[model samples]
Target: MAQAQDMIRLQDVTFAYEYGDPVLEGVSFCIPEGESRVIMGQSGSGKSTILKLLLGLYKPISGEVYIDDEPIGPCSEQHLGDVRKKMGMVFQDGALFDSLTVGENVGFYLIEHENLTIEEVEERVRQVLKVVRLEESLIDKMPEELSGGMQRRVAIARALLATAPKIMLYDEPTTGLDPESATQVLRLMHQLTRERNIATIVVTHQFLDALAIADKFILIDKGVVAFDGSLADLKDSEDKRVTSFLEPFRASLRLMEERRFV
Candidate 1:
């Protein structure tokens, strides 16, 4: 049974693509309310697969997935939709609509799902945009008119519009940005987690960014969890797989230090 504080839980879940080998095997993890988990792995290592499973985009072949302590494997589409309403997802790309104004994009879900007047939706949009530190003036501009960081912030705002999500799933939220821009996005994520008490799961290869927002760390290797613990444990891990996965980051930092003294 899930405790009241547990917002997301997966118990011995397994999944595979159609006609493909297993992508996940006997995986289990839990994220409590107001906490953040970072999932890191190489390409095709089932990092994003975990996010999909949580969203019910892909159901597990075996075991159970629980959202807000409710089992989702047997849920109907309508029920899944209800579960999804408590969650928000930000994709690798901002995934904003180029055709819509920033305001329209931010308030899109509320307009479609809730019985809010245009004025009400616009007010709510402004509030979320403020949370992302975006100005109200950008609301009238098209997506193409904004910078990449602005677009990503807009995406975050959009995700928060419908309801105050209990969970936020970010798939490489800081990908394809300058370090400064990436830091800005990471800071926003940190702020949201702290201020809104939202449980967050970030799937990314960005080691530094992941460290910045993660309260717990998970490293997946070949469809299984290779390591799962606090960031301190990750740094101290002497496991072969963990060491091998971290070697590149360690080398990069060493090179930076060498260059600094040169």
Candidate 2:
């Protein structure tokens, strides 16, 4: 196993849009290399804010964000750009250009950063698409031609094209899919983390998404971390708030048992 000290680290990071209050307060955590962590929270709980902070899109008010132990605040623009190349992020909506075909979307990064010939870029795009189980025929299809699930798979394929070994940040990956499709996305995420040996952090509100994968899970509430542990530990937590939040889940299970024919 990789050493725990050298993965992604956040040191007392805090951020806020205005001076009224902080969105993330003294948040700190370390994700070991190749581990999958799910950051869960209700609305306004700062899950997405953490993603923004790590991406260096927003600066922390007090502390620092680090990838592979390099501090990530106020760095030179060129240095920050270099650091960003080591990471890949997928947004909630997949963020594909409406005009671009699936292959074009996946190859966009290579077109921008690499001096590879067209054949080389196409080969790389094909390789990553296979990782996401997208067929070659889908390459010519535009984003509008694919279903919601297919679009998300395309987004994942785009991220894998970066070939970054350290980190992949996913923001609400299972937001808009049917049950089976959502489960497929979650399982794919688990497989990708293991296969790529990359540190994966997912910020999501979907409890099912958390249960489907997540080697380590943390709960964010009211701008603070309320819990962090394995899924079994979360299921057994005695905290009233945690129990209250999970009550409906349990109740639904009992109802299912009572009405099996339904």
Candidate 3:
């Protein structure tokens, strides 16, 4: 077993956008390395805010965001840059460059930040693609040419590059995917967390997206920590917020059960 610490954390975090109402109020959570946490909530319930706080893209009003036990305070961009290298964030839309090929997208960080040669960058790109199970032949293919699911995988591959990040953050990873594609992406998320031993946090309002990966589950309601526990705890909770958010999962299961009888 890996030695686990609070690899990612938000302590008493309160945040809001400019001239806006607070999105997170007194929010607190910790995730250990080599574990996965699924952060669930209704839309606009501050799920994505937690991710941005951790990345230090947004400052909390009254608390701290930590990565690898280091607090992300008001630090220099150079310092933040180094801290961020230890984390990989995947956006909801895949976030690939439009004009860049798959390989170019994957190798972009190295190309911009490192002194690696073209051959070295290309080689590293191919290797990470393999980690995400993308074909090497897709290297030169444009992002527009790939399926949505494949694009997600490509995004994951890009995140895997530079160095294997200690923390991996996914925002609405399975939102727009079909059930089959969603499952594939979710499974790959689970596979990579185990194989790479990354501390994973997924933010999604969709219950089904979280069904496949998570060592712990956290539900945020109205900018506060509503519930945090194992799957069993989630199922057993009497909290109306948790239950309402889980209705989709329950409905999905009921549908599956009905189908089995057919």
Candidate 4:
């Protein structure tokens, strides 16, 4: 049974692509409400797969997936849709509509799904943009007019405008940006989790961003959980695979420090 605070739980989940070998095996984890969970691993290690499973985009071949404590693996499309309402996803590229104005992109969901008039949707867009620390003035601008970090925040604002989602899933939210831009994105994510009490699952290969916002760290390797614990626990892990995965991050940090002295 899931506790009241448990917002997402996966129990012994096993899954594979059609006619492909298993990508996840006997994986299990719980994400409590208001927690920041970081899923980190090398490419094709099932980190993003976990996010897909949570969103009901893919069902497990074995075991159960619970969203808000409701089992969704066997639910109907309508049921899954309902479950998705409480969840929002920020994709790797921000996934904004270039054709639409920032305001249109932010309010697109409400404009299409809800019965709200244009004025109401615009108001909702204004509120969510505020939550993401974006100005109302930028609403009329196109996505291309903003920096990479601001575009990501607009995507987040779009997600928040509709149901004020209790859960936020981010897939490589800070990839392909300057260090300053990446830090800005990470800070925005951390602020949102703290202010809104939103549960977050971030899939990334970037260690610095993970270190910035993660309360819990999960490392997946070769389709299984290699480590799962608090940030301190992760740093303390003696597991060879964990150590191996962290080598590059350590090297990067050392290089940064060395350059500071030079």
The numbered model that scores best in lDDT is: 1
lDDT of 1: 0.88
Residue 207, candidate 2: C-alpha displacement in angstroms: 0.6
Each model's lDDT comes to 0.88, 0.81, 0.85, 0.86
TM-score of each: 0.94, 0.91, 0.92, 0.94
Per-residue error for 175 in candidate 3, Å, reads: 1.8
Instruction: Tell me the tens digit of each residue's lDDT in model 1 across 83-184.
Output: 999998999999999999999999999999889899999999988888899989899999999888889999999988865799999999999988778878
Candidate 2 lDDT at 170 equals: 94
Q: How far is candidate 2 from the true structure (C-alpha RMSD, Å)?
A: 4.1
lDDT of 3 by residue, 1-262 (tens): 2224878878889999989999999998888877899998878889888888888888988988888888788778789988998999999999999999999999988999889999999999988898888899999999999999999999998888955799999998987889878877887888878777789999887665565677888999999999999877888888999888777687574444332211
For every candidate in turn, the CA RMSD to the true structure comes to 3.7, 4.1, 3.6, 3.4
Error of 1 at 171 (Å): 0.3
Q: Give one digit per residue, the lDDT tens place, for model 4 in 1-262.
A: 6688888899999999899999999999899888888898889999888889998999899999998888998899998888999998999999999999999999998988999999998888888888788889999999999999899989888888756888999999999878888877888788778778888899998777677788888999999999999755766789999989887777565444332210
Report the poorest 10 consecutive residues by lDDT, candidate 1: 253-262
Model 1 ranges with Cα > 4 A deviation: 251-262
In model 2, residue pairs whose N, Cα or C atoms come closer than 3 Å (at least 3 residues apart or on different chains), thus clashing, are none
Count of residue pairs whose backbone atoms collide, per candidate: 0, 0, 0, 0
What is candidate 2's lDDT per residue for 5-75, written digit by digit as tens?
Answer: 55688888888987668898988887877788899878998999998888788899998888878888968
Better of 3 and 4 by lDDT: 4
